[model samples]
Target chain A: MEGALMATEERSAKSDHADSSTGMLELRDIVKRFEKPGQGEILVLDEVDLDVEAGAFVSLLGPSGCGKTTLMNVISGLIEPDRGTMRRGGRDVSPDDLSLGYIFQEPRLLNWKTVRGNIEFALEARDVPEGEWDGRIDRYLDMVNLGDEHDNYPTRLSGGMKQRVSIARALAIEPEIMLMDEPFSSLDEITARDLREELLDIWKREEKTIVFVTHDINEAVFLSDYIYMMNTDGEMFARREVDIDRPRQYDDPDIAKREAELYREFHEHVVD
Target chain B: MDRLTRYLYTVASIIALLALWYVGGVTLPEVIPGLPETYAALVVVLTTPGPYGNMFYFHVWKTIEMLFASLFVSMIAGTVLGVALGRNETLESTLATWIYAWLAIPSLVIVFVSAIWIGFDASSGYFAIPLVITPFVGLNMWEGTRNLDTDLAEMAEFFGAGRIQTFKDVVVPQLAPFLFASFRSGLSIGWKITLLVEAFLLTRGVGFMFRRYFDQYDLPTMMSWLIIFVVFLIVVEYGVLAPLHERVMEWRPEAEGVRVTE
Candidate 1:
């Protein structure tokens, strides 16, 4: 644990991209609206405020129509929030400018490329020094426990294997802020559980800030340091902190207690 | 074992076709030449350097040359037009009807028009095949481009790939099966149109030789020549196309679909 913190300190010191002195990545009063053909305007993200510390895992916990995805999209620069400020260390830059890495809900892998080739595609897109590619790919895929399956194609893989590749692809970019939009939502329960554990492992080892989005309350409880609870009206209604220790057991009494506490709050705000 | 079973099934199919041909030869001896007679005539025709001092190799070479030249032009033009039509609504709406109309016009009529307009020349013959063949290739590509996986394209965009890289890396691979299918049909249709153009217009080609054998009503020689031509197509199919297909789509998992037909 001390070693991971030391690495995070060294990483933040070495890279001038993100400054944590002013509370790191900040999103304040973000507003976005979409116009339907019949409807005049539909407000998706309404003046949302979020502050992410450097090298922390934050999840937006919400139900299906809660604008978690739209906020994620805003962070990734896929769409701009109409009236808001998103700044990295007081600079008017969105999250993507800092070599943003994204993992979609689907694997979204190129079916033609091999497992190794998929990572290579990301590496090329990032223009990471070509010399560093093989090393990064090897380390990330090894971290994801996909070392032996580099030559396999996506179709040949199971759902879990493909999601692992997606994780490896996202991490291979070495982004300062990694955005995941319900990445493990479609997987079976057992697979999702295993991947959540593995994701936490990678998160600790890499020490990169992650903004994960999911509708699963337990998923947010298990994975995040800070869970921003959101409701169906495009508002982040509440926030909670999970203070569980690392390498958390599945049936830890403290985790279940925290989940039980959040469950009531989740129902009151989100499901209602 | 899969390869062996696949080859065995194909061999069985070929034997069944040959048995039917033999029955037809026995039943209609005057019209259909049996394998024995066709083989005999094939030996005679292949051994003789030329038919009546005109070299068969020259005609064969001309037909092949014309086939390649026209197919090259059509494949490029067709794929470009097809992809363009697919990517844009205005282009698709304007040209799709004209392309179908072109496809409906007979290859014979196209050749006649080319002969009358351009005069009987080698250039005219080369130019005529694309006119007949491009529409079919374009239609194949149009359908493929329309069904292209836009999800993959979006993924490419999220990865920060440029337009060129996305088209080359993502779009091209998805459209490859359609491109290859168009190529195969283009080769088949291109050669037939080449024969039509050569027979009516050019002085030397396999199509002219076919016209002669057709005039004489020499069923055995005609069948021999046809069998040899089909052998070339078989060599291309197995030697070139099948291997390329395996390499390109090696990522696809082999599985049978559930029965949908009643």
Candidate 2:
């Protein structure tokens, strides 16, 4: 696993240098507000800027209600920011133009659909070629280690299995950018740890840009190549690069050190 | 406690109620007919041909036809209109009061007014029955559609599902339980309203036969028809609606404690 991680890093480093453009996903001067009942408009996102390089795993780490999910929603085009411009592949693009996939905090699988049915639904919606559907569904399901659970309904699956199906569903679309909002927050620690490893493996193989939102410091440290620490007021307060070697263990000293440093940084930010 | 015990209890209760009714009728013949007399009267009605020729067959058929026709029309029209109202906030607000008013108005009044306008004919019953049932269905569907999972909806849209696709895949599945609830209730209410309309209009149905018996003072025959109609309703409720409900809700995890036994 360690050797494979090193090889992936070497390849990613070379590819990162090959692309000279700004980023695969670029947000400039993004602002958003919400209307409170008694109070007037409250600013949620204040002139936030972010750039995600192609095939990079980035985490937006913040406390609860820190607008991390809101930022994701804006990026996914589920909610439009009041003012902002988003660029993909160095060209201004709407959410509709980008082939985007989203894995919400909850496994929002259609209860009436089987695992295969859910994947097919996404494929159909994305207008994937009918001939390619079976191959894509089978391949992605196997990627998530759920090849045999194709006929099972969501209600029959455990929490971890359901989240895996969700991952498979998102990957089946072959999206350029995948927006995940705390996808594993609801799972038990053991299950979450396993999924995080599986996710890192998938990310290395798929080579897709992922913008993950979570409040867990260890999670952000474990998964991200770059962690953007967000303040409670929705501002990007700090950016840290995890220079440690990959195939990182949960109890690895380096990861624990980084996790402690992030915790301190978060507390200091709150104090500020 | 268990399935057999539950069935036994249900049977015991029914038998106890029948015993009480039989004793009451035998003691006070003026008010109620005994069980034996009612059964004899039912046999007579089943076998004998009235002025209309086989009153049981013809009238029962007409009632069933009207009941189902109204239910079918109301289900389609009500669902469409309800979905529209639920989706459009401005339209819902503008017409909410009118929907409430329609619900407030009695079915008897609607039947009478419809008969006055369209005349006391078979057509009037058909028209009035849909009008009576549509509002209930429409209102239930409106609430159901309004309360749909917006998160799922946003997810569908984010994944590039168009409006029609979202409605079919996300919206309709969530509304299934509500739709079935409305349908079952609407059917139950719809048949009763059909009978009332038929009675008032003196048209060709079980209601007309019931009215005919009332005028002739044939108490036993009238009671017999009532019993048969109630049995028919029970059959439709359990045999048709229950099975359909079970099928639609089969995806839901079974409740821990509930059990059904035949």
Candidate 3:
């Protein structure tokens, strides 16, 4: 009941953001192709266009090798597209200059560092001005509900906790854009479900732009305000604007029906 | 199997060895001296404080001092050169052949080279050990630093970590075990070579004491000093080397439970 209200609130907020900003990010005719060592050129992304308003939670849904990850990478300025330009805040930003927070599929936490240390490392590199660390670390750890586990090492934490730490590490930098590549794809169903809710809460609290890539249709439907579905060859084949109200519950009828329908749709597309 | 039984077994082994030594020395008078006579000599030498009595401790200290001096000098020089070489493929390839060939050159050759350059002086061992051991240390640490987790390296870079920050935060912490392992091996080799150099070079320490005993035809005194050297080696192995190793390995997060094997 509360989840539905939160979901509605999130949808309205996203709509407002979309209308207010021309677009925080605009992808112009992007194409990415890679050449294998011996194999010929393989087209990964095919003339993709994406518009993401600032502070919007958007999910890119597709099967494996669908170029969803490539698109995210291109948007993050980690990789260059063969023939395209990405404009952020109405200016062309180079890959080296853009500050995009990336969350890998693996936690990628420094094994030697504790959870707090891992988060602090992100700020350590930038000129974050000393003495601002404790407040920032505490704020994010509290958001992830990991305030107690600050001193715990990555090895000691559960997979879900490690992923939460990774998220915290990313958010500590307060990036204009956050790119997550199936960050919860490796976890068990129950933990993944809980983390999805936690992630939505974080997205709500911070209101930072997010681009999430996942093969799971239900995950996309449950979390995303807008779902951009991609084909195996890296084309943005279909897109769905979700209107499910905020704080959405997995058990809600609208969420369940939409999840099932998206699943069927993706399954059919993957099969054909 | 039991702790008490293990303790008893260890005590019994030592008692038996001592008994065999006593019996063998008494039974064969011409071949071996009695335990009493050896003990008498040991007591006289131990009670007297002079060059002979203090020789073993003095020599052990010399060897350790020289070894560490060489190690300290080489580690700084080696790590800097190694990181530079590891990051640049062209430099690595250019220097790889020369470095390996230099490493292959025997310690004896290096000792002779040190003698030629520095002469038979106090600095001989110091010069010799680092020259013999630096290449091996540099190469091993270079490879370890090169093969470090690239994903973590990328993460460091994405966080705007410059060379120094990457080294301190990412490289050092991850490469510590490897670096320490190389240090242990280098230290062992360095000290052994220092002792050999002491025996061959300027004669003032234990090596000089051994030579004097040999000249006087005192085989027992030579053997006693040999025993002292063995005891000194044991002390260093356990007291110094082992503790340092434990300290380094303690940095590992897994060291809390079962012993981490580096």
- What does the TM-score come to for chain B in model 3? 0.75
Give a tens-digit lDDT track for model 3, residues B1-262: 6779999998999899779979988798666656676676556545555553564556656666777898898787777777778888999889989988988999998898889999998787788888887887888788887888887876787678788987787888877876777777787777667766877886765565567767886656665666666676678777987787667555355534632211
Error of 3 at A224 (Å): 1.3
Ranking by DockQ: 2, 1, 3
Docking class of 1: acceptable
In candidate 3 the C-alpha lDDT for residue A183 amounts to 97
Q: Candidate 1's chain A scores what TM-score?
A: 0.89
Q: lDDT of each structure?
A: 0.82, 0.84, 0.76
Off by over 4 Å in 3: A1-16, A19-22, A33-35, A40-43, A65-67, A80-82, A94-99, A251-272, B1-57, B92-100, B116-118, B122-124, B207-262
Ranking by TM-score: 2, 1, 3
Residue-level lDDT tens digits of model 3 in A1-272: 11111112123335455533334676767888999789898888877777677777888888888888788777666677889887776787565555578898888888777788888888888767769888989998998888888887777777888888999999888786788999999999999988888888888877777889998887888888788777776667556777898888888899889888777766655566
Q: Which residue pairs collide, candidate 3?
A: A3-A247, A6-A246, A6-A247, A7-A245, A7-A246, A7-A247, A8-A245, A8-A246
Query: What is residue B51's positional error in candidate 3, in angstroms?
Result: 7.7
lDDT score for residue A172 of model 2: 94
For candidate 2, give the lDDT.
0.84
In candidate 1 the C-alpha lDDT for residue B29 amounts to 93
lDDT of 2 at A100: 77
lDDT of 1 by residue, B136-196 (tens): 8899989989998876776777788887888888889989999889989999998888878
